[model samples]
Target: MTRFPLLAGAALLALATSASATSFVATTDTLGGLTANASESTSDISSSFDDDKIVRAARDDAASFVASNGAIRGAQLEAALRHIRQQAPQVQADDQQLARAILAL
Candidate 1:
């Protein structure tokens, strides 16, 4: 019957009612309202560790940390963690994962 087709069409329309999210844009005014975050440690551990273009110190630190089988935590390992946090602030992980990512690079 015609009623069945109308019901099916109504159901399809109801299923297609997903709305798009478009309000996440940060306008200039919104950006200006935010304060500068200076509490975070700004020291770059690899600043002195780099030479030319190759990041050998990070690799060495990661390699040494890996050589310890993750049982030993040292200044080199902490340097790797600081390097990871400085480069990728969004990364939320424990020491092992960050070390693995550093060595994997």
Candidate 2:
């Protein structure tokens, strides 16, 4: 009946909204962790860590953060890009790799 259709539509909408909101939170957390790790790497580099080691560490941290949080989507990727630009300007290699991975997602 018409009531069935309306109920189904409402359920679908609710489910979609819930999924999107969860995705946003997960992506935000992942990106925030990446930004923090990048800042830490930058500090290590400034403190005389090898550039190659810093990049490697950052890449590993980013990968781990994404893996533990969830898969990134288009919107999440965009959020990460904006976050990187604002949060960690000095980040070069790690941020670049993270951006590429997010875009790939």
Candidate 3:
């Protein structure tokens, strides 16, 4: 009976090894063919933000507004939003969004 189990186990092991050999080589071949593009690039996300005159203009006001916990709105902040739109009409953010950005700073 012990001999029968040993033979069965050996047969299973041999079958497993043979099946794994084909799949293992196949997977390795596929992996060797895979590669990343050499021209892939990355950039700083903050560089895309509109932090020029608009963000700078709202800096002082933002500190106060942030300190007030969103309760206070400053005149300079409004002016900054208007200035941003005029200076760069392509800007698509709304008034509250612009103010929220300042509050973050």
Candidate 4:
């Protein structure tokens, strides 16, 4: 009878719904583990690179130079570089990262 088919379809739909809910719970647990792992690694990296005193001083000096003159050029460029080197002697003129960091300021 048509009623029998309707009842079978309703039962199949309920089973499918319950199966999907179980799969979703499993997927959510997996995602939670991944999120925890990522958070731990992110904290480790942040603590490792948390600014050094020398780098901080150099950035401050660069900021001051920019504030005072509006733009660095010619002898001013040399002076800014010299000031940074004086504060942190390890920084070379051609050190790309330092240059980029200072310029970003």
Instruction: Give TM per candidate.
Output: 0.39, 0.43, 0.38, 0.40
- Identify the leading candidate in terms of lDDT: 3
- Which parts of model 2 have CA positions greater than 4 angstroms off? 47-105
Q: Itemize residue pairs with steric clashes in candidate 2.
A: none
lDDT of 3 by residue, 1-105 (tens): 899999999999999999999999999877664422111110111133346666677878867776776677788877766765675565455455555565544
Scored by TM-score, the top model is 2
Estimate every model's Cα lDDT from 0 to 1.
Answer: 0.54, 0.56, 0.61, 0.54
The residue pairs that clash in candidate 1, if any, are none
**Candidate 1 weakest ten by summed lDDT:** 35-44
Give the higher-TM-score candidate: 1 or 2: 2
lDDT per residue as tens, model 4, 23-97: 999999999987676555434333433464434445555554556563533443455455555655543334333
List model 1 lDDT by residue over 1-105, tens digit each.
999999999988766663211223445445554422221112222233335123345566667677888766667667667766776675455566555555554
* Each model's backbone clash number: 0, 0, 0, 0
Model 1 TM-score? 0.39
What C-alpha root-mean-square deviation, in Å, does candidate 2 show against the real structure? 14.5
lDDT by residue for model 2 over 1-105, one digit each (tens)?
Answer: 999999999999999999999999999999999888866655544443233332333444455456655343344444554555455566564544554443232
Pairs that collide in candidate 4 are none
The alpha-carbon lDDT assigned to residue 80 of candidate 3 equals 68
Q: Give the distance in Å from residue 22's predicted Cα in candidate 4 to where it truly belongs.
A: 2.0
